[model samples]
Target chain A: MNPVVLCTVARMMAPVLLLFSLVLTVRGHDSPGGGFVGGLLATAAFTLLLVAQPEELVRRRPRVDPTRLAITGLLVALGSGLPALFLGRPFLTGLWAQVPLPGGGALKLGTPQLFDAGVYLLVLGTAMAFILGLLHGEEEEAREREG
Target chain B: MTPPLLLTLPLLVCLGSAALAHLCPRRAWPRRGVALAAMLALTAVGLLLLVEVRRQGVLAVQLGEWAAPFGITLVADLLSALLVLIAGVMGLTVVLYSAATLAPELEAGAYYALVLVLVGGVCGGFLTGDLFNLFVWFEVMLGASFVLLALEAKQEQFEATLKYMTLSLVGSAVLLTAVGMLYGVAGTLNMADLATRLPGLERPGLVSTVAVLFLVAFSLKAGAFPLFFWLPASYHTPPVAVTTLFSALLTKVGVYALVRTFTLLFTQDVGLTHTVLLVMGGLTMVTGVLGAVAQYDVRRLLSFHIISQIGYLLAGLGLLTQEALAALIAFLVHYIFAKSALFLVSGATARASGTYDLQQMGNLYRSHPLLAALFFVPALSLAGVPPFSGFFAKLALIRAALRAEHWLIAGTAAGVGLLTLFSMMKIWREAFWKGHPQDPAAKQEAPSSVNVGWGVLGPCAALALVMGVLGLGARPLLELADAAAGQLLEPTGYIQAVLRRPP
Candidate 1:
């Protein structure tokens, strides 16, 4: 099932998909694209890699365990709410700031963006965990049949 | 000290511990330690929230400082506070029980993290003031429970989980549909706003239809009659600790939503809606008790009883009186403690006898007198025996039913009580009184006796003691329930607090 052309295409597409996911996440503040969709995109990128190179992906596990990644995302999301509490506002109150670029244009940032980032990581981790778990189950079944 | 802090602290502690537990994958003790600390902190915060709510009336905060009906609001009236407190205490007990009984394979599967997440979801469900937020909490709980149920799946476990998951997803779909319908009709998803707007809505028929959808969805979740087939099928499949946690919190969450929605938002058509509830309650009780009587498996029998007791809560809600709601709240508090204790005791008994079948178990009276006594207290309480918490709970509910002149339901409640006693006695005679089926003389020598550790017994005893205390000190809880009932009946204060507008 692993054709050379398909593998080559997947290798190229994976990086592009990941980069696009980040763009979607960052632009989600006032647009249609948000963390949830962006995270799914990132998961799709990983899925492409796994399909093209299953053994390599399995042997060299991702840098972050999927379960831990989801947990970290949850902490990040919850932590985003804490800053508002410290500022004496209600929990999850958006605190915004403007950062000026070298060219004099300013970038607007807020707690909601932090929350979107958290959602992005959470969605990616959770989807990958489900995919990997199913793949691992199939592999085990195949091994059992061979034995 | 702030309202938002009180509402969110339990969730933060739970998720924080979950994250911490996941950080160390290979180690068990560190995760256990984190869970234990988190549960202790949860219980302490729950108590503080209860106290603060009592002092300040209704405590509410709109997240992000958003205006009412626009942003998410968290509110802790007496009922929410009480439920949160019970959830915290039950979480603590279940975590302790799990520490002793959970298999190494399960522990390595991130079991503690899942449990903490489930508790956090339960707390969020109790505290949220928006309908959509409540749905979100339900999903959180459902997701965690699905994983927990199938964590180290065997063939039968997977089958049970499939049944559970499918039915729960259907319930969620129905719930979301109802939420959408309500929003379409009223143009808002905030519960406080809904309460004010529902009665005045021009489309009364549409409102009733949405209410029925809500009833069906919550009834499925609460394991009420005709829709409760999934409960007994799946509840007995999980590990005992998992079963204990589910029995303690999950169904009650459904009942809580039912009570909250009916009293607050659906009061416009009590004659039609409450009557259906009354009939459903009666049937649920009858079916549940009869089912319990027919079961020989201990967990399955208790699972049926959970359904029966939920009927009592529904009946109390059907009466639609302040006294009735108060009695229902009292019953809820008693039921959670008694039911959890019973499940823990059954788990211990199963451990000692190496079987869950009542027909296969015997001679615990002589072999483990302490465990026998521990089981007796909750069993009797569950059967509504006097000087135990369940007696007072049942008595109050019956009195409320009588005063409300719900003669048939009141009679059904009493009849169901007698049947419950019979089933509890069935368990007693089979598990504790009868001699061992294999070898009566060799029962003490059974190797499984060593497996029943203090970790299980300690929580059982503590819960039994709590039942006893609640029985002896029933007045305070009754008063608290009365206040909570008042708040539910007259949700004006809740609405005013959340919306900051005159109704």
Candidate 2:
């Protein structure tokens, strides 16, 4: 099962792919790239790791469960919409604040971006859950057969 | 609460409870408690909303500050608000029934969470003023119902799930395609806006085609005649808790949508569309009652009658008169209360006797006479026996049809009532009148049928009380229905209220 060349390449490519996914997530509201695309990119990187080290990767404790990440992300996104509701506008109406950046451009933030982030995490969590569940199921079936 | 909060609070509570339940799946206490508490709070909110709607005529809240025809809107006229109120009652009742009936493993898993989500979806469907939002809510409702239906992994359940799942998916697909085409035609998804735009379309034929598409999609969900095989096949396979919930609210939501769309957007083609409903409604009533007469299982029989009652609701809508629409509203509320009570009664019967098959059970009339009386109230009402809620409901429907000069439909409804009585009597004779068969296979170790817990009896008793009040005192409710129909018949009030436009 030893494939040093492919394993080494996967390890090298994973972190770079994650960085790219992060960039895609940050600029999502202002431009084409956003949470959903970035989440998929991150998922692709993790999927590569899953393929390369099926046992080692799963054996390690994930800091956050994929489902939990999705749930927390959804809560954050829903919370982002609460400001408008409290301010007597409407549910999920985007409220914005403009902050001048040190680099001379104004940075604007709003709730729609938060909603997109929720969508992104939801996609990521759902994909990972499906894959991990399948992988874990196969392992259990094999163990049962062996026993 | 503000209008927006009033609209969103029940949904938020439901989803928030579901999320909490999902997070703490192992801790049954918090999860179960949270769900029940959410339902209780929702019932209060629903009552308040109904009060507000009654006082204000129509309440509409545009979400995200986007005006009507532009952003999502949640509106609760009397029709929607009253349905929401009934659904809230059903939600609380189902939760109570499940608490006493469902297995510990199920309660500890995603069951209550999914149930909450399903409740949220149904409430959302009733409240949304946008057609696309209604479709989204239907998806949510179907997803949870599918899971709840198939949760039992037996062979019969496996088969039932496949049938239920396939047909439900097809319904959703039809709905989506129709929504897409409607948007293409009118360029708007808001219900009020669509009503204004649909009449202006150049191609009446194409509009009729889309009307037929919606007709098929909604009727499939409503379990109308010739397309309702899935109901009896799958409805009886679930636990009593799920059976009660599904038999009560799910099809009624479809009927609600059909009533809304036909009365609102598709009225331009009422000559064709309403006629389709009239014919289909008559067929559904006759077939559903006949189907019930053939069944030995109590729950399956009740499931068929679910179809029959939907026919009454649809027939009222098809008549397209002021009085007829009032009957639709009245019968809808009456059926929701009485039918759910009947389903819960069946659950108690099953709990006491350990089977859904009427042939296997016996002598409950002698042992638990009070329970038998409880069944008789709703069952007789369902059969339209005099002085009960069902009698008044069917009478109103028939009288409306007669007043509109729909003699054939009036005759069919009257005959369906007779057949409905026969089916109810069939259950009464088989399950109550006959003594237990001596064969070992026919009878289980008989529990003390008279010794019933409040947990199982309380919900049914509450529903029965409401039915009696509706029966003995139909005045207030009939007046309420009058106002509700007034709202539905004249959509201008609703449109202006929702869009905040000049009258």
Candidate 3:
């Protein structure tokens, strides 16, 4: 099952996949792709890693809990809109800020971008949760069968 | 205060508490404290919205500074605000009751978070002024309810949820399609906007078809006669607290949507549509009571009664007079209070006696007189006995029907009132009047202590007192209801309020 070239290609492709997803996420509001597609791409990166070493992905202690990630993502989504309320605008109103950059240009950031980031985290967490849950479920079934 | 914030505040409070509760330790009492504060805040905001709506006539605000008919609007007319008020009251009482009796079970199941989310969804559904937004709120409500209903995934819940979730999804799908077709025809999903544009459409037949579509979808949720298969089949399987919350709020939301649409958008063909509602109301009444008569489970019996009460509401709406609308509001108040009280009583009784079967319950009249008294008031009130809120509510409905010369509907209303009495008496005799059904030795050796704790009995007594006042002091409520009815009879104020146009 372990093909050296395939594993090496997967390792190389993971970061590229993640970088492309984040780019898609940042550009999603004005263009076609956004947080939803970015989430899938991030999941794809993880799936590639799991494919390279299924045992390692399943057996290793997770550095992050997908559930906590999802919860945090939801909190961020909910909280991003609260600043608008404080500014005497309606709930979920998009509030923008002009950010001066290092060189000469300025960047525009707003609640919409914050919301997209939250959605990105939610999708990533949910996909990870599903994969891990299935792995654990399968492991439990195997143990039960052996017993 | 902005009208949109009325909707958003409740959601924010409830959802924030839910998030915090989820992140906290399972058994943390601080989460409970936060939940209690959240419930109190919800009640306060709901009451504020109600008062504001009553005083201001109708208040509507568009989210994100978008103008009306373009963005989703949150409208607080008298009807929605009133429903929200009762929901807040019910939520507060339920949370308090759960804290007293269900701290361990509820904490383990994250019941507070689920209940909060459900209430937020209900309030949101009641407040949304856009059709598709109503559907979204319905999803929020449905999603939370699905989890709460099957929190433990008990065997019966698994079976019941399979049925409940399937039918509810079908209801949602049909509603979405109806929203699509409405948008296709009128290019508007705002309720105020639709009321303005729909009447001018050339194809009356197409509008009536959509009317029927909405009627079918909402009736399925409201548990009207033919489409009510899911209510009795699944409602009684959940834990009593969850069942109580669902029983008091779920179908009523359906009725709210139906009343809103039928009164506003579908008023073009009154003869065909109101008559359809009238006949459905009568059939729903007879079948529901008959179903209740055939059931031994107390919760299922109450579940069927929910349908019967809905029948009364439909009949009142079919009449579509100011008095009839007033009667409808009055009936809504009596029903919400009395029904929740009855369910809470049954829950407390079940907790004590450890059964839901009428045959297995007895001696309550002898053993626990205060609890028995609490049960009696609401039970009689439910039967429309005089000196209770249900009596005045039913009287108003009958009087309005007779005034409108809807002689047949009036007769059916009276007949349903009598049948309602029969079922109430059935519970009374089986649960309270008869001798104890437990073992003789256990009864003989029983300790003499009446454990009618305030947490158990307080809410029931308070609600029953409110029902009593509603009957005895029906003046203020009648005036408030008449004002609400006035708002409905002429939707100009409501529409103009939402659209920001002077009528």
Best of the candidates, DockQ = 1
Per-residue lDDT tens digits of candidate 2, residues B1-503? 77777887777777777777778746566778878988898898899998988887788888777889988898999988888888888989999988887787678777888898898899999999999999999999989998998776678888998999999899899999999999998899999888888889999898999999999999999999778888888998888888888877889889999989988889887889999899999999988988888899998899999998888888998899989998888898889888888888898888777788999888777666777888999999998997888888789999999999999999999999989889888888877767775434334344355466788888999999998999999988888998999888899987887778311
Report how far off residue B331 is in candidate 3 (Å).
1.0
Cα lDDT computed for each candidate against the true fold: 0.90, 0.85, 0.84
* Candidate 1 vs 3: which has more DockQ: 1
Error of 2 at B87 (Å): 1.2
Clashing pairs in 1: none
Residue-level lDDT tens digits of model 1 in B1-503 = 77778888888898888888877655677888888999999999999999998998998888888888998889999999999999999999999999888886577557999999999999999999999999999999989999988887788889999999999999999999999999999999999999989988999999999999999999998999879988999999899999999999999889999999999999888899999999999999999999999999999999999999999999999998999999999999999999999999999999888899999988877677888999999989988999999999899999999998889999999999999999999998989878889886655563345446788899999999999999999999999999999999999889989998311
Can you tell me which runs of candidate 2 are displaced by over 4 Å? A1-3, A99-106, A138-147, B439-450, B501-503
- Candidate 1: true interface contacts recovered: 0.74
For residue B147, give model 2's deviation from the true position in Å: 0.6
User: RMSD in angstroms, candidate 1?
Assistant: 3.1
All candidates in order of DockQ, best leading: 1, 2, 3
Q: Considering only N, C-alpha and C atoms within 3 Å, which residue pairs clash in candidate 3?
A: none
**Candidate 3: residue B275 Cα off by (Å):** 0.8
Q: If both were scored by lDDT, which would come out higher, candidate 1 or candidate 3? A: 1
